[model samples]
Each structure stands twice: as structure tokens, then as C-alpha cells.
Target: MTAVVEQPPAQPKVKAGGGERGLIDLVLRFREAGILGALVVLVAVTTVINPRFLSAQGVEDIFLNASILALLAVGQTLVVVTRNIDLSVGSVVGLVAFVVGDFVSGTQHGVLVAVALGVAIGAACGLVNGLLVSFCGVPALVVTLGTLYVIQGLNHYIAHGEQISAAEVPGAILSLGNGDLLGIPYLPLISVAVMLAVGYYLRSYSSGREFYAIGSSPEAARLAGIPIRRRVLTAYLAAGVLAGLAGTLWLARFGTVVADPARGWELDVVAAVVVGGVAIVGGVGTVYGAALGALLITTIGSVLVVLKINPFWQEAIVGLLLLLAISADRLVALRLARVLRKRNVRHG
Candidate 1:
């Protein structure tokens, strides 16, 4: 009889947990899930309250309206994930919108050239912000806040109290903003495509993981040889580009641009990013969640109008939701701290 060696026992793979604990773990591990849940609830409630809310036209309008904010929110998500913020997005949007409008309305420029110029202008602004924050080591919040004023001032001076009219806008440019493809509005479709691309990159790429690492612990990320400066700079650049794109969409949708278009929009972008579950402290969120947050906020405004709720109450409701989101974040952080402490004690 031949002696046969017994094969080594197979190693058991660790399985992730499931059920309510799993759901809680999911939310804690990825805060975006909570924002997504809130979005679902908001949609369901609105649909129940007004069955017409589910109509195709209504859906399209909601998405189209949300697209501009969603684009800015995507950039905000990237910056916030790296424990940074950009307070100049609103101004960037306004300035870029005006630039694009001016170009298109001028006798000298074509639609393509105008669009290119608009995007480049936005990118340049972002680069300046990045240089100040990353190279000069200025705080991001301060740098962006200053840029906010600078850009807004420039916009006002350039416009000189004038607004571009719909009659002056090019047909091609207008179509790009207001037209639809395969039944989906162009603006929303563009936003969806961008969100998907950015989301994938953040979730699937090594550099993206580095962003999360930096946000989670800057010191550790540095020790691990991650290029923190480069990543941060790149984040700002992406933000500028997205802001430009949003500005373009805005011009098309509104069929004009004024000096102060999208004023106070930075707060809306920040709120969407935070509400989508990106921790204020940094290193935890998803673009999809942020987009959903934008949708929810936009829907809330529309729903309020439809329900005939007092305009003042809309702000109050939004404030309450924001408060709840912050509270949830704190609870998760505390629980995580307790878990780590218990584990340390056990190890000791």
C-alpha cells in the first residue's frame, strides 16, 4: 500500500457580517450609506404626499436642477475627503458662468472656443487656490474664503451691472445645457457620468486609497510615502474643473449669466457634501452619496413649494436634518473610539 500524505486543511476565509449589525456597520464604515438612506426616505415621502412627484417631467426637473449643485458637491466631496474645503466654488461658478456668457454673446468667439476658455479660466482659479494651500501652506478654508471675494469682485467688475440675455446666447451652447439624450436631460446625464467616473476612481485606484489614508491620518500617510502635497493639489484642480463644468451648465439652463449668479451656493455644496456622510474631520464619504444628498436637498425645496409649507419652515427643516446628520456622525465616532479602547484593553 502506498503511503499518501494528507493534504493540509483548507483555511477558512473570513466572512463579512450581515443583518441589522451589518447595516449599522455599513453606515459606520461608509457614512455615505446613511445619506443615501435619507435620500430614499425623502423621495418616498414626497411621492406619497404628491403622486405627481413621480411624473417624468417632475423627475427630470428635479434632476436637472440638482445637476449644477451635484457637480459642485462632487468637487467638495473630494476636498472634504482629504480634510480640506473649498469655499470659493460659488464664486468660481459665478465667474465662469459670466465668462462663458460673455464669450458666447460676443461677435468674436464661437461656442467651442467660449466653452474652452470658460473651463480654462476655472482651472486657473483652482490652481491658484491649490498653490496657496498646498505650496504656501495656507489653511484651505482661509485661502478659499479670500478667493471667494476676489472672484466675486472680478465678476462684478467685468459685468458692470449688465446681464447676458437669452437672445445673445448661441443655439449650440443652449442645446448643450437644455437638451436631452435618450430621454435623460443633458445636464443631469453629464452629472451622472461625472459622478460615476469620479466615484470609480476614488473607490478603485491606489491614489484614491491614498487620499482616504491621508484624510484618516495625515502623519501615517506621510510615513507611508504618500505624496500628500501632490494629492491635495490635484484635488483642488479637479474641483476647479468641475466648478467650470457646472458654470457652463448653469449658463445653458438659465439662458443668461449675471455678476452674482449662484451666490451663496458654496454653503449648499458644503451642506450636500457633509450631509452625504463625508466627515467634517475628513477621510470618509462617497460621490454617489453626495449626489444623493444634492437630490434630497433639491427635492426638499420643491416639495416644500408644492406642499405650500411656509418658506421660513423650509430653512428650519433643513437645519434640523443637518443637525441630525451631525449627531449621527458624532455617535459613530464615539462608538468607534469605544471599540478601539476595548480592543486595546483586551490586548493589554
Candidate 2:
């Protein structure tokens, strides 16, 4: 003990800006958290204004209304996550719904056949989009926009001023649309199941993770040997199939088919994607966020109607939300830049 030298006071261990960077990452990574908070606030305020807004019927109506849009948003997420867009989804839905109605309108063509046909039609549309974008290297936006027009034209030409009414829709198909278990509506259930499955795949699968990689940096992904074209093609295929499935579900739920059932809905789907935190420039969002975004929009519409606000205010509100998302994204980017700069200096 007498021979022991006095040790210098120990310096406090530090990870530099670990805590600050962690907080930053948490804020950036949990982008959907903000959306969830907004939803809770919306529900609370609306429920306070109108007790019936929380009524069972009102809740069911909101979920039912949101189901199809949620599905569209899910598929749109796949495309968007790969730094691509699918503007043709709405037209694809319109096309598939009419096709399903035409195929199973009167005869007992059964549920399976009608669904299969719609899915196939959608797959074809997706394949075309994929081929052009992947092989020809055309911009996703341009290819999808062109396909949207073509599909819309084809749908209208096929319908030729005709509509399919509930009476003509098969009972089997309608049953799936309207049926439920334990008092839960099938449409919302199906939409939720689809969202969960896609969400799981995106979060857990290697291929799915590659979608984000591609979106994050196409050139880097190619250097990593990620088969960019194939992944992009598959994304389009999945989107088309979902759109087709949604089309059939659309017919089932509404029991009425028109030449343009989902016309102008592409914008809503994109809005939902953006609102859900999926960057329009690409790589940063989740399907769950997209689904929530869809649900929130539908809920907001219901709330506004209950509150007796001017109908015009709805679109304006949505536009404001979009702007907020963009602004938030900009803020996040700036934060990351600052964080990296600091880390580099500390290591330098």
C-alpha cells in the first residue's frame, strides 16, 4: 500500500454525442409516431364535439370506408419504397373491378374465379409497367402515367357506358365483402391482414429490405449486386396484384361497378403515402405508416362532416398535412447532416 502510486483521477467515460445522436435517430426513425399522435388527438377532439362520433356505427363506417384506400396505400408503398411510383394503380383498380363484374355479373362464376380474373388482369398491367421501367429504363412516373391513360381508356372502352349493379354481382362475392366474424366487418379485416403481412415481409425479409436499399441509392444497390431490375419488376407485380385484389374487394363492398370506380384515387393514395412519412423522393417509409395514413384521412373526413366544417376545408387540410410532412423531412435531413458533421470531427 505504501509503494502504490497515486493514480490520476479517472476521466468520465464518454461516447461523444451518443445520447444526442440516439435522440435524433429516435425522432427520425419513428416518423409514424407523429401520425399516431395526430390520430389520437383528432379522435379525441371529434369525440368531444360529438359523442356519437365514437358510436359503434360511426367507427365501423370509418374503417369500412378506409379499407380500400388502405389497401391501395399498401401496394403503393411497395412501389414507392423502391424509389418508384405507380400512377396506374387507380386505373388498374377501375379496370379490374369492371372486369370482375363483367366476368361474374350474373352467373354463379363463384368468388375464386372472379378474384383470379381480376388478379390476372392486374398482373398484366403491372408486368407492362415493370417491363418498361426495368428494361427500357423509362422513368417510373412517365411509364405509370402512360399506362394509367391506356388502362383507363381500355376500361371505358370495355364498359361502353355500362355499369354493374348489385343485383348482377354474385352473392358469393358479396357475402365475402359484407360478411364478418365476431361482429367485425370482413373488408376491414381483410385490409388489416394484408397490411400486416406486407409489413412483416418488408421488415423481416432480405429481399424486402433490398427495396429500401434500391430506393436509398440505386447506384450503390447495383454495386452491391442487388438485381435492381428484378426487384423493381417484382414490386410492380405485387402492386398490380394488390390493386386487382382491391378492385374485386371494391366490387364486393360496393356491389356496384363503374367504368371509373377508382378514378382520381391515385392522388389520394399518393397523399396517404406522403402523409404516412414515405418520402416522395423515395426510400424512407413503412406500409404500416401508409395504412395509418389512409385510416387517418378517412377518419378526418368523417370528423369534418360531423363537425359541420365546410367541405372545401378537407382538401385544404390534407394539403397542409402534406406540406408539414415535407417540412419535417427537410428538418430531419438537416439534423442528419449536422450529426454526421459532428461525428466526423470527433473521429477526425
Candidate 3:
């Protein structure tokens, strides 16, 4: 009476449909495609309005001006993609810039040493932020908000109503800030390199893909054995390093540092990241889009000046653009959800 049981047949894999609807479905799944289109339109319109916008010198100026902001936006994109935010980057930038200026102006320090000190200080501050948020289990917004005040206060205390002037900074460092390579500024070139590195990592590496997975659905990611906490801490750490790098660049460019050098810049950085198609709730974005967003915002500011529009209008325009971006994000999310629901229903 040794009887054998029969096994069921294997189910066939269902091939995905191929057509315009499929293409639309793909686009809806990634909201970045739409933002990319918008960025192209913005560039075209700006170039049309002022052909000078495409001039070599003008293009270099735009890239140079957008460089630091693009760096900050990339960091902001990482945090936002993790469903978190860091409000302390502006203060971090100011503090690090001031520190580097102080060191460079001091009798004992040189350009390289000053840059190293500033970067180290920035990393320390970011480490504190990461620890507070990741280990203490505090909300990132709350922790960074507190750190913002703390860091700003530290900056004021250290500065003690003093400012470092451009005259005191070394010529070499100043050159770093102002010099161009083959018609492109060094800072913008560095920013592009960073964007490319980060973009490649997030798109191609396993650990990088894990970040997207975690952002897309933390619970599912956890169940799938992803190291969620470590990944988040790593994201914050990367952000902090970039913030430090930006501080160094700011120091080089301005050749002067004040306690409030980049005050309120976090808003612009966050806005750029959001406008670049990084979801506030997490999961989607690219450094290229973030850079484009930075360029767009910077261009709008320049256009305002060129058109003789009030500077206040620049801020207003940024606000409107952010609102529009958020609205578009929500609409796309809704469409994707509806499509997913229909697909699930049909499959079930």
C-alpha cells in the first residue's frame, strides 16, 4: 500500500501586452518622464525668449550658478526618496563654509587643510543627524529641524558677529571657485560628476536598487530581507557628505563666509528635488532630473532679473511651480493606482 501522489501542472507565464496602452502604462509608472518633458519645454522657451541663453558664456554662468544648488538638490532627493527630509542642510552649508573660511584665514592653515577641515565638520554634523534620526527612531523632519536651530546657533556663536572677507582667502581656493575648464566652471563640472556617479549607483547597483525598493514599500522591502535601517542611514550620510562638499564649494566661490550664508536654501533644494520628480512619499527620482530642476529654478531667477520683474516674483513663481509639480505627482499616482487596481482585478 505504498501509493504515490500526483503533482499539479506548472502554470504558464503571462506575457505582458505590447501597444500604445502599454507605453502609457510605463510612462505613468514613472512620473519622471513627464517632468523631463516639462524641463525640455522650459529650456526651449527660455532659449526662444533670449537666444543669448544658449551662448557659451551665458550657459556657463547658468551652470556655475546652479552647481551648488544642484549638489544640494541631489542630497535632498536622496532623503526625500527615502520618505524623509533634512531641513538642516542650509545651516550645515553655512556652518561648514564659515569654518573653512576661518581655517583658511587662520595663520596655521592652507587651502587643502581648510577644505579638509570643512568637509570633516560637515560629515560630523551629518553623522549626528543620521544617528538621531535612524538610531533614536525620531522623525527626520523633527530631528533635522532641531539640528537646524542648533547648527545655526553654533554658527552665530563661532562667527561672533565677525565675517571672513574675500581678501583673506587664498588665491588657489578662490581660483577653485571661479576658474573654468574648457569653458565650463569647475564647480558645475564637479556637480555633473557627482550627479552621474549617484545616478549610476541608484540605477545599476544592487544596494542602490535596494534603496528604491525600500522607498517604494518599506514593509515589503523588509520582508524581502532588505536592510532598511542601514540603507536609510547610508542615504543620510551621503546627503551629509554632499552638504559638506557644497560648503567647500560655497567657500571657494564666495571667498567670504557669514553665519547665515545659505539661510533658507533648504526650501529651494527641497523644491528642486520635488520638482525633479522625486516623490515626497518616496520611491522615484533621478539626479539628472534634480539637476535639471535646479537649472530651471536658477534660470527662472535669471529671467526675472532680465525681464525686470520684481525679485519677489521669483519666489512666487517657485512656489507656483512646486505646487504644480506636486499636483502632477498626485495625478500620476492616482492614475497608476487605478491601473494597478484594474490589472489586479483582471488577474484575480
Residue lDDT tens for model 3, 242-286 = 999899899888887878799989888988888877777887677
Encode model 2's per-residue lDDT on 1-348: one tens digit a residue.
Answer: 579789977543212257554654476458778888889999998899789999988998899889999999999998998889999999999999998898887899888998899899989999999999988999999999999999999999999999999999989999878888899999999899999999899879888888887887787787677889999999999999989999998999889888988998898888888899887777678888899899888888899999999978878888888788878877876777687778788989
Model with the higher lDDT, candidate 2 or 3? 2
Please report the TM-score between candidate 3 and the true structure.
0.88
The sequence of per-residue lDDT tens digits that candidate 1 reaches over residues 254-337 is 887789799988987888887877777887778887887788788888788777888777677667777877787788878766
Which parts of model 3 are misplaced by more than 4 Å? 1-55, 106-111
Candidate 1 Cα errors over 4 Å, as ranges: 1-25, 28-33, 106-111
Displacement of residue 93 (Cα, Å) in model 2 is 1.0
Q: What lDDT would each prediction earn against the true structure?
A: 0.83, 0.87, 0.81
The per-residue C-alpha lDDT of model 3 at residue 247 equals 93
Task: Score every model by TM-score.
Answer: 0.88, 0.90, 0.88
Clashing pairs in 1: none
Q: How big is the positional error of residue 305 in model 2, measured in Å on the Cα after superposition?
A: 2.5
Task: Provide backbone clash counts, one per model.
Answer: 0, 0, 0
Write down the worst ten-residue block by lDDT for model 1. 12-21
